[model samples]
Target: MGGAARVRRGAMRFGVERRDRPASERRAERGGTGRSPARRRCVGRPIAKARGMTHSPLRVAVPLGGTDRGRSGLGTWVQAVLPRLARRLRARGGELLAIGTPRDLDAYAAVLGEARPETLPAALDRAGASAGWHLAALGRLARRRGADAVLLPAANRRLSLGGPPTLAVVHDLAELHVRGKYHALRTPYVEHVVPRALRRAAAVVAVSGATRDDLVRHAGLAATAVRVVPNGVDVERFRPGRAPAALRAELRQALGFRGPFVYYPARLELPGKNHLRLLEAFARAARAGALPHHLVLTGSDWGAWARIDARARELGVRERLAWLGRVDAAWVPALVQEADAIAMPGLFEGFGLPALEGLACGTPVACSDTGALPEVVGELGVRFDPRSPEDMARALATALTHPVVRRRAAEEGPAWAARRSWCRTAARLDALLEEIAVAPGKAVAA
Candidate 1:
């Protein structure tokens, strides 16, 4: 009658296969492992078999948050990983199960068409009230589907499903470390939900070693419990190419821009991104006539757009600023490739994927010297103190003026980006899954 009930029926119908049975035999006789009445039943039979059978398809359940109605950094990461994971798993004779809230189901379904998708109860949307019921429902569903492993694509409340081990990708430990920096509404959610999830996860993957260390130190997670898996770029999609004159013309006309442009491709989040400071820096540079290039701000989330617009006007650089709100995915690579230099002045980040991507497109980068940006950018680009507008202005001026620095960054940046790939990230994930399945005790906190 319900999703969980239907899943239970499916699992009962398919049953568990024996280790001794041939692949064809198992397929032909889809019955529960007919063990002797006197013998004890294996509580994790389906999961054990799923892991033990090297060639057998692994049924992985990946739970996601709501899809990006706005082109958000987190959304971009999800978009990059999910479809790639699905294809890779399918190729290795595995199936994927995408579980998300009703808001996320349609988008996830569209991306992972072949994989089975389950939407959680709509009542779970209420703040702080649905944790118990949500976990219970998720656990039952995962057990019914006999998931080999469950992947939480984003940090949320952890589900203690009895059937499968869980893997959570902690994008950052910003909530734990940078208190009172985010919106008041989010503070309670993070305080209650995130730490509990981190403690319960079988393996915690951080986007950078910096974030991993933060998790270990601040969240009381064991260092050995964490693994550093850096976010990667789509190399094939984001390569250097000539931007069509028509598109350039459109952008110029829309924004009243008639000169070379430097792009800051990120959401207009305050405090965390330090966007107000960035605007001040841009204004300082503009007033000095040091930065001849227009500044383009791309990707604005809800409630953030108006703030950024007001900041631009107040800075007196509204005419020089282009607010390209949520550009198409296909256009992003092209836009990055066309920019003279890509700037990320964020005060903190788990991993600066945009900087990595801009470098991959052979655009020189100028970013902050904080959080994971230094680790991600390495020696490829210029680093500035995000807190100081003067520092940012100076750095932008130098980057724009210095040909030798830009040349070296442009030459070396793509090669750096090329070294990290989604394929490689996925391979590492596969190994982690195997290790967790075979020797789960090894995954215990250090």
Candidate 2:
């Protein structure tokens, strides 16, 4: 294993904290006088109480899947939301159990040190098959541990846990609607497994209204079953700031880049993310002398990097292109702060977390008006049709040339970002858990 992987493995040795004991034991350990019957009823028993009863802390099980430790959008949201929910739930006299795959257990433990864990005995490489097995295992585990509710950060093949009512966070219905590309294989999984999971889940949480609509339209889920919970940002983590002088100097010297640069921080996935179209647009802008800025692409995967490099060379703008593959997450805010603008020409997204992150950093953004981009950004940034290079070139040119627009975006963007917070997201999640623990038959909380 590589150094990073080794470090991640070392971190998982420390086991996760779980609330597997009875409610009386938990209350006594915390120095409580006595556990109330209502509290005890709320802990391991089904919800069956008078309306408007005071809420109690619930034993919640959160399952981590898909990029749960990285700086990617989904990972970032999960990292922010889960711990806060755990902390808040604990304060309210409840407990949290975080379930993770054996492969990701270490990475997750590294990020969420004190959260309780129930490690799934399977690898994540085989996502579809592993998800089915893990879900069944999680159901049995939740019942054995007396968990009040279970949550999946991402979708799985099955979620029919015998113990607590289940919930899932569905980012989008991409595999159902968008076919004939890299995601073609996922069509079968999405069509067969996702609907069943949705049906089994008591509540379906979508990251954006667009995603909710997509799920209702394509997956045939009832609108009432889905709740729109937009993704949030860590305002303090990603704010307007200059790059550290030493680090900036080191990176500049290392990359041999000395001009203003347009930054694109996303995976180099083909088809959906559309890195080829971005390369084409950047080359056209460079050739026409319309843009004097260097293009900096920062992400993972060298195979995709080679393809983009060849395209840049074919367009004769290889000298103007720089690839800084996978930088530390701490440096992202500073790098985005230094850029003229952040560009995301993705063809689809569940919530477009990076766009919101860039905006939180007070950087102007130029993204395609596709998928959940418009929903996240609203009128705060510039947009273009992702399918056309000419449109992308025009949007890029506009962002580069218009100082007033950039300034306005910087002035208004942070406040827009401030509207969404992990704290609030957790509170909503807590409310849902309370509802499920009390009355599973009641329609899911709005």
Candidate 3:
């Protein structure tokens, strides 16, 4: 556990202040409590009695425009969550509004039948515009709709131009940690804009405690201002016992891999995701006859593909590696089901979704145990040093060779994933919304 221990120690001394919580309780989580009901409906809808209604229910505005596929993990997150949030707001007779281009509006409308989506101004459709311009468009939209609060679900690149209660959900600060992972345009955004946006926000939602700490360390945010609401897994969609034999065969054929294969479903990039080290480890294991399976990587190359491909060839394991770029998201659970094991060696992660999904599907999981990976995987996966190819090779070998560890992963993984439902995650965000919307004076215990 040297690597895991080192990671824990490094995080503790990462120069971020750690507040002492009273041992009596952990008031740690997302959203605020006691959101009292309003006397009226939403702003647009009129009151009767000659209008019997009084004050209107709070309106929450969410922006939803972006391409899915390989473009944005933010897209994936918003697609999964906003619909659920819409349902919750509707149940309370509150309004949930969406602002985006037609593509964005349609995407949300498809899921949220009752969702009120408006196409944004044409200026927002142009690329390379300033974040301030985008925020201005949203502010005008918010004012028109009489929104009480605005949630920037994918607020990594931009901050509010100032309007109603504005909150941003920060997934990770990977740029602060790994400078080379992002492109030039994005480098400035992460370094300058994201921090400013977060600081100016009414409150920021950090997806993990590690991320909350990053907010404090990198962006100089108050620990009290950043709420820790973890990302979640859809257990029913990713659970064990859903892998039918015929569907498994079909998926394997489509992915063009046969026999036993270890899966690493991360985008191909530089040293950030540690794909180079993973290929090195896999090659060494294959050469030593320690590994009997091929390695299937299932994401498009963000950058460094030529280098990664060349390295695989040099390692003499090119044929043993399959570069299945960006398969349909729907195929992920089935792919996890068919894989012999799941190996992740990312240098950092705010939360490791694929690892958790693989575990949910009862697959043996191996990861670098750095950043949020240890907390996300818990005991359901094996941990190794991402910096050491030898350590990673041994961990992968163990996951494939050891019977007891493999058995525990299959038998105990569901329970681990079951505890991390999207509902619970959404509830935390909902609470944070309440706090930001109504109880602006209070600190979020979560």
Candidate 4:
């Protein structure tokens, strides 16, 4: 009856392929870095360092076990960090194995060349259910593959109960803020399963200080147990520039928009993402006629989208709003560049990736003062209370008005974004993993 029960029916037999690591330590090097060349073409500074790995080689696997592409924020985090991680590990004479569905595996292949994906018991694939099964399964496979440690790149609390040292990445504890939003089994999993999982990890990586704090307060973990490694934008792709003329023309025809627009690119998650309140604010701006910009909402329909659509109609922004569904990561830059401003009115976030991405593109950003947003947004954009539409409307209006001061902030935004580099994040994370692997008297410390 529950999601976990179904996956249990078809539990997997851990027969993941064999002999992934090199027999000897005479390797050359790993893949370079993660930032795509298209983005790099504009800003030549590489975000992934080419520094060789540690003296003692350690096998590492960034399992996609709990992270799904496109379907979750973990997807974005992986797309940004894993490639660089894979390379850094390989440079250290370590192997990086991907464990996920065929599609998820393929997504990482381009960034991590030819590292075969591992799987769970055959029956579990059909069940297509996630009840933290992958958590245990991945741990077992990592041990079998002789992995020194495993990195769980998603925010899910599900974790491998035992086996190799594990590091879990916590994005946010939104489930606690908004009760009754997730499915029946999921609620229990997060409340019970996650804290236990955090305890199981050798160490934990929090995307922001806020997230690190939540882990301590909500999960009852020690502050020393968590480390803050904020997310970084792909400055190469997100920097200021128009879309390819062809791209602009194609999008114009499809969306039929004639004026500059404000972008709110995030999955349509309910009160959690605060889409409804944003719509109300946009409606107020429209009524006042102070801002004539269109509102573009990209990303798939998550839970409360019907409510969002209905509210959109109520606010009379149906005409001004453009629903682009999900935009490919490749196109996010042009989308941000072409916009008048980027709006992130989420109730909570571990790290506001889109807001940073917008700033990297030299576009003004308007975000809520809650969560890690205020910290991430800093003075780059206007901050308002996500609960008040009047506040959001005013922030949106000021950004669109294009004041000289705001324009200067937009102009200086990219350099500010560049300072938060994936290279730096990766270096810090790499050091942490090796610290866990080589700690004396224990394989890892929590």
Winning model by lDDT: 3
Report the lDDT tens digits of candidate 2 across residue range 1-446: 33233223322311223314345323322323232212222122212233455677688887775653555677777777777777767776778888767666676665565478877666554666666665567778787888888877776333454557877787776545446534455677677767766766778888877788787876678877787766767777777777779878877785687789888988776766778888887776555445689888887763577788788888888888887778877667767877888889988877788788788778878788777877677666677778998667666665665655577668977766666666556656667677767776443433
* lDDT, each prediction: 0.66, 0.69, 0.69, 0.68
**Could you tell me the TM-score of candidate 4?**
0.83
Query: Which digits, one per residue and each the tens of the lDDT, describe model 4 over residues 1-446?
Result: 33232222212111112223232110201113333333433222222234443346667766665565545566777766776766666665676777766666666656657254675444444322544465546667778888887777874644666667777788888777666555556667777778877876788888877787788887878877677777766666778778899888777776797788889988887767888899998887666655678889888888767898788887778888888888766567778888888999988777888888887887888788777776676666677778898777767765666354357557777766765666556655777777767752232223
lDDT of 3 by residue, 7-81 (tens): 344333222233443331133221123111121112222212122334335578887643341244566677667
lDDT of 1: 0.66
Report the lDDT tens digits of candidate 1 across residue range 1-446: 33233223323322222224234323222222332111322111233234554534567887664335225666666776677667666766777798766766765455676577877766655534344544556656776888777776665334343447777777775655456566576666556666665676678888776787787776678876777776766777766665678876666676576778888888766667677888888887666654577888777664567777798898888777788777766667767877888889987788888888887777877788777877777766677888898777766665665565577667876666766666546555665665565544343474
Candidates in descending lDDT order: 3, 2, 4, 1
Q: In candidate 2, where is summed lDDT lowest over 10 consecutive residues? A: 37-46
The true-versus-predicted C-alpha distance at residue 372 of model 1, in Å, is 0.6
Deviation of model 2 at 270, angstroms: 0.3
Query: In model 1, where do residues sit more than 4 Å from their true spots?
Result: 1-55, 66-70, 125-136, 156-163, 177-181, 188-193, 440-443
RMSD of each: 16.0, 12.9, 7.4, 12.7
